[model samples]
Target: MTEQQYNECVNLYSDNVYRFIVKNLRHQEDARDIVQSAFEKMWRHRESVEFDKSKSYLFTVAYNQMIDHLRKVKRINLQEDFTETTKGVQHQQTPQVKKALMEALNRLNETQRSLVMLKDYEGYNYEEIGRITGLNESQVKVYLHRARIALRNYLVSPENVI
Candidate 1:
């Protein structure tokens, strides 16, 4: 890729990739670092990257890096239990509602989250999502359907409503 193409790739994908990482990780600093790492890897490989396939390449790199980050952070934590306990403090929307949404998201496997985000958040079509995530179009559709159903169930549950 030329310098021009590299700049275009960054402009086109940075926000979408950042949002995806932030939504999953729920940490702005971590999301920014992962996005930077993904783009850096993409930049390093630009010569080999097809211009038409840049979005997919960026997302794939980001997804892999996110997995690695999660793996590295895996550990027992007493503070996390305290955090969970304090999460019940009352609020307008109620922590339970937010928790249910997060729990619903967590219920999805990694691939399902990718597909749902690509479709629902990024507004990518199934073919585009399939390309980005290395799945087939049909697989993307199926995973998206399942993810939506799971989220809907959580959101519409009687306890979740005010």
Candidate 2:
């Protein structure tokens, strides 16, 4: 990738990459750092990366960085804590349905949450998601399906409805 190509990538994919990281970490500053780090890593390896594949490369790097950050922070979200957090959100003016959806999303493990975000929010195909997530295509399909089912169950549970 030339300087021009790198600049174009920064313009085109930065928001997408940032959104992915933010969804995973829920910390804007940490998300920004991870996105910046991914771009820097891409710049360092520009000679080897094809311009066409830059987006995937950026996402892959950002995902790995997020995992490392989560491990380092030991920021495990217990079920009770997650529920309490969502209850706080629910008490605010945010729609009850949206609050429920977010609570369900929070309940997911990191891999499952990433799969849903990449597929549903980012609109990446199964193969592309596999590459970004380090999963096989079949594994991506199975896991995403399960995540969707879990989300649906959470949304439909009577106790969750306002």
Candidate 3:
């Protein structure tokens, strides 16, 4: 990618990459660091990444960084714990239903949650999602199906809702 293309890619996908990381990491500061590192890696490898596929490239890098960060930390951090680490957290402002849905999402494993975000939130198709998560198309489909079902079951429980 040219410098101009890289600049455009940063403008277009920074928020997307950041959002994806934050949703998975649930820690805005860590998410920000991961997002920055992802962009830095992309910047370093700009010669190899194509402008047309920059979105996927950026997301893939961010996802990988998030995985590494999680592995290094050795536990999935929850939003409640994350809030204790910093002020002005936005978890207080979300609607009840969205909060419930997010809690349901939290019940899923990493792959499942990432699949849901890549496919549902970011509008990535199966092939693209597979490429990003290093899963085959069939695996992506099966995991995503299971994730949606899990979300449904969680939401169906009266105790889980507002």
- Kindly list the per-residue Cα lDDT of model 2 for residues 40-148, writing each as its tens digit: 9999999999999999999999999999999998885632333332332233445666667778999899999999999988899999999988999999999999999
User: Which numbered prediction scores highest in lDDT against the true structure?
Assistant: 2
lDDT of 1 by residue, 36-147 (tens): 9999998899999988889888888897787788779862121222123334344465566667766677667766766776787678888877776778988888888988
lDDT of 1 at 58: 89
| Residue pairs with backbone overlap in model 2 | none
- TM, every model: 0.74, 0.87, 0.89
Q: How accurate locally, in lDDT, is each candidate?
A: 0.75, 0.86, 0.85
- Give the number of colliding residue pairs in candidate 1: 0
**Candidate 3 displacement at residue 18 in angstroms:** 0.2
Counted clashes in each candidate structure: 0, 0, 0
The residue pairs that clash in candidate 1, if any, are: none
Q: Which scores higher on TM-score, 2 or 3? A: 3
What is the model-wide C-alpha lDDT for candidate 3?
A: 0.85
Worst 10 residues of 1 by lDDT: 75-84
Question: Which one wins on TM-score?
Answer: 3
Query: Candidate 3, residues 17-47: lDDT per residue as tens digits?
Result: 8877787878878888998998899999999
lDDT-superior candidate, 1 or 2: 2
6 Cα displacement, candidate 1 (Å): 0.9
Q: Output the lDDT of residue 25, model 3.
A: 78
